[model samples]
Target: MGRIIAIANQKGGVGKTTTAVNLSAALAARGKKTLLVDMDPQGNTTSGLGLEKNELDKTTYEVITGEEKIQNCIVKDLFDNLSLLPANRNLAGAEIELMTVDKMQFIMKHNLEKVKKQYDFIIIDCPPALGMLTVNAMTAANTVIVPIQCEFYALDGLTQLIYTIELIQKSLNPDLTIEGVVFTMYDARTNLSLQVVENVKSYLNQNIYKTIIPRNVRLAEAPSHGLPINLYDPRSSGAESYDLLAEEVIENGGEN
Candidate 1:
């Protein structure tokens, strides 16, 4: 079976989607059969992978709402080993539509289960909120990778996110656990960044990946150009950092 990992952070502007896009692309470049699932209604992940969100007839919205099947919503062979289940603005209404449905939290889990064994890793890009969509992603995932921006408020709301994870583990998916935390937007020139990293290392009782994603212009530009950092500029520091993160993730294997 594939390792279902959700790239999630309730806090926005923390490189959650950036990590989702690049890490999935990196894994695919490493010859791993990877599936990138865009659960966020914003659909940045869909566009980041070069898919036109509005042009697609069916998406994660339809899949989750039972208007379509998961298999049919998947866009295969976007890259050599990468596939995508695109999302769009329509997904924003899924919570309200599923409110009356029994066991709605398990809907994503059940849908993903049907295609779990077909890939090596299934990476989900969750929205930057603790809403029903994020809850569904967590309930369906074996683990979560949180992207924390290195700044003064890096730790803010982190406790709440951890508490939510604990709640999910206890009430929803007992197998759910935190895979690790990744530090992003690091500026080596600033002591504040170093301080924040040290603080998180000392206080947060979770595995922290060694790869620190720098605030690279190329990283920021790639999304607008509809390509991953590796494909856009393989020589850039952002690409190097994400490739290292992918290696660490692969090294961790099925441990989490």
Candidate 2:
């Protein structure tokens, strides 16, 4: 069975999607068969992998609603070992459509179960909100990786996110636990960034990743080019940071 890891953060601009995209790509680059699921209605993860969101017919919306099979929705050949389940603005309505359905929170988990053994890792890019979609991701995922921005008000937002995770563990998925906390958009020169890192480490205690993603122009620009940092600029610091992150994740899972 594949490990389903949801890259999530309720707070926006915290590099959630960036981590999802690059980490998935880096894992693929490391010879792991990876699947990137775009659960966020914004579809940045879809497009970030070189997909044109508007041109797609099938997406996460169809899979989540049971209108389409998971195998039929996968977009292959995005990279050597990476495949994607693209999403678009259409996904934004899934929450409302599934509102009255029975076991709505487990919809994603059930859909993914059908294709569980096909990949080594399944990375879900969740929306930056505590909505029904996020709840669905939590219920589906075995674990979650939180990307925190090294800036002001970072810890304030983390408290609520932690509370939400606890609630999900109690009621939805007892197997769900935090995978790790990754610090992103880090600026080593700034005191604020350094301070935020220290605070998050102290609070999280363990399960925090050692690799800090620097605020690089290449990282921010890769999405516009529809490529991951590894493909966009493999020699860039962004690529190096995400590559380190992938190794950390692999090691955390006790994989050789």
Candidate 3:
């Protein structure tokens, strides 16, 4: 069976989608057959990986809504080992509609059940809110990775996210666990960055990753070209950081 990891955070602009796209790409680069599931209605992950959202006939929304099978929905990307279950604006209405449905939280989990064993890893890019969609993702995942920007009020959201994790663990998936945190858009020279890192590490204890993603223009620009940083500029710092982060994930998974 594959290890399913959800890249999730309730806060936006924290590099959640960026981590999902790059991590899936990097893991696929390591020869793992990976699936990148774009659960966010924004479809940023879909477009960020060079996908044209209009060309997709089926999406993750279709799968979650029982309109299509995951196998039929997965579209290949530039990475040979990576496949994507794209999402678009159609997903924006799912939360409200799903709330009225029976077994609401199981929709996404059930959609992925058939295909979960097909990949070495499944990465879910969750919407930036602690809503029904994120609940479903948490229920489906074995682990959850949070990408936090080293900015003002980073720790403010941390408390709420951790509390949500606790609730999910108690009520939904008992096997679910915190997969550590990665600091994004970090400026190494800033005392503020160091202070934020210290605060997060102190709070989370060992549930924080050593890899810190620096603010790189290439990372910010890659999405515009619909490319992962690794594909856009493999020699860049952003690409190297994600590559090393993937390596650390693999090592932590004890496969290295």
Candidate 4:
């Protein structure tokens, strides 16, 4: 079975979607059969991977809502070993619709079950909120990777996120575990960035990846160009950091 991992952070601008797009690309480049699921209604992950969100008729919205099968929604061979379940603004209303459905949190989990064994890793890009969509992602995922931006108030909202995870573990999925925390947007020239990293290391009781994603212009620009950093500018520091992070994820037994 694939190791379904949700790239999530309730706090916006924390590199959650960036990590989701690049990490999935890096894993695919390493020869892992990967599925990138865009659970966020913003569809940034879909576009970041070079797919036209609006043009797609079938998407994660339809899959989760039972309007389409997961297999039909999957866009295969977008990159070597990479597949995508695209999403768009149409998914924005799913939260309200799901609230009226029975076992709403388990809808995504059930849908993904039909195709989990086809890939080695399933990376879900969750929205930047603690809403029903995020709940569904958590219930579907076996693990979570949180990206924390290195800046002031870096730890803000972390406590609430942890609490939500605990709640999910207790009531929804007992197998869900935090894969690790990654630091993003690090600037070596700033004492503040270093201090934030150190503070988080000391205060947060979680596994922190050694590879810190620096604030790279290429990383920020890749999404607009509809390419991952590795495909857009492979030699850039941003690409290098994500590749290292992928190695760390595999070394940590990603297959499990």
TM-score of each: 0.98, 0.97, 0.96, 0.99
Rank ordering of all candidates by lDDT, starting from the highest? 4, 1, 2, 3
lDDT, candidates in the order shown: 0.94, 0.91, 0.87, 0.94
In candidate 4, which residue pairs get closer than 3 Å at backbone N, Cα or C atoms, i.e. clash? none
* Per-residue error (Å), model 3, residue 185: 0.4
- The worst-scoring run of ten residues by lDDT in candidate 2 lies at 247-256
Candidate 3 lDDT trough over 10 residues, lowest sum: 247-256
Estimate candidate 2's alpha-carbon lDDT, on a 0 to 1 scale: 0.91
* Candidate 1 least-lDDT 10 residues: 247-256
TM-score, cand. 3: 0.96
In model 1, what are the clashing residue pairs, if there are any?
Answer: none
- lDDT score, candidate 1, position 163: 97
Judged by TM-score, which candidate is best?
4
Q: After superposition, how far is residue 22 of candidate 2 from its true place, in Å?
A: 0.2
lDDT of 3 by residue, 36-56 (tens): 999999999999987888677
The candidates, ranked best first by TM-score, are 4, 1, 2, 3
Candidate 3 segments exceeding 4 Å error: 254-256
Write one digit per residue (lDDT tens) for candidate 2, span 56-132. Answer: 98999999888899899999868989999999999988989989899999999999999878888899999999899
Clashes of each: 0, 0, 0, 0
